[model samples]
Target: MVSKEKLNRINELSKKSKEEGLNTAEKEEQHELRTEYLKVFRERFKKKLDSIEIVDDETGNNT
Candidate 1:
C-alpha cells in the first residue's frame, strides 16, 4: 500500500497541477508517484482476484 504521506503528496500535486501547473521537477515527481501508486494498486488487486474461490453449484464443482 502507498504510504499516507505519499498519498497526500499525490493529492497535493494534483491540486497544484490543476490550479497553477507544475514545474518540471514537480511533474516528474508526480509521474513517479502515480506510477508507484498504480503498480501497488494493481498488485493488490491481482492478489485479491487470485484468492477468490469460484464454485459451480449446478455442476457440483469448484474452480
Candidate 2:
C-alpha cells in the first residue's frame, strides 16, 4: 500500500495543479507518486483475480 503521506502529497499536488500549476520538481514528484500508486494497485488487483475460484454449478467442480 502507498503510504498515507504520499497519498496526501498526491492529492495536494493534484489540487495545486488544477488551481494554479506545478513547478518541474513538483510535477516529477506527482508523476512518481502516481506511478507507485498504480503499480501497487495493479499488483493487488492481479492477486485478487488470481485467487478467484470459478465453479460449475451442475457438476460442483472448479473451472
- Candidate number of the best TM-score: 2
lDDT tens digits by residue: candidate 2, 12-62: 999999999999999999999999999999999999999999999999999
Residue 8 of model 1, lDDT score: 100
TM-score of each model, paired residue for residue: 0.92, 0.94
- Please write out the lDDT profile of model 1 over residues 7-50, one tens digit for every residue: 99999999999999999999999999999999999999999999
Lowest lDDT sum, 10 consecutive residues, model 2, at: 1-10
Q: Which stretches of candidate 1 lie over 4 Å from their true place?
A: none
Error of 2 at 38 (Å): 0.6
Q: Report how far residue 23 has shifted in candidate 2, in Å.
A: 0.8
Instruction: Report, for every candidate in turn, its global Cα lDDT versus the true structure.
Output: 0.98, 0.99
> After aligning candidate 2 to the native by TM-score, how far in Å is the CA of 60 from where it should be?
1.3
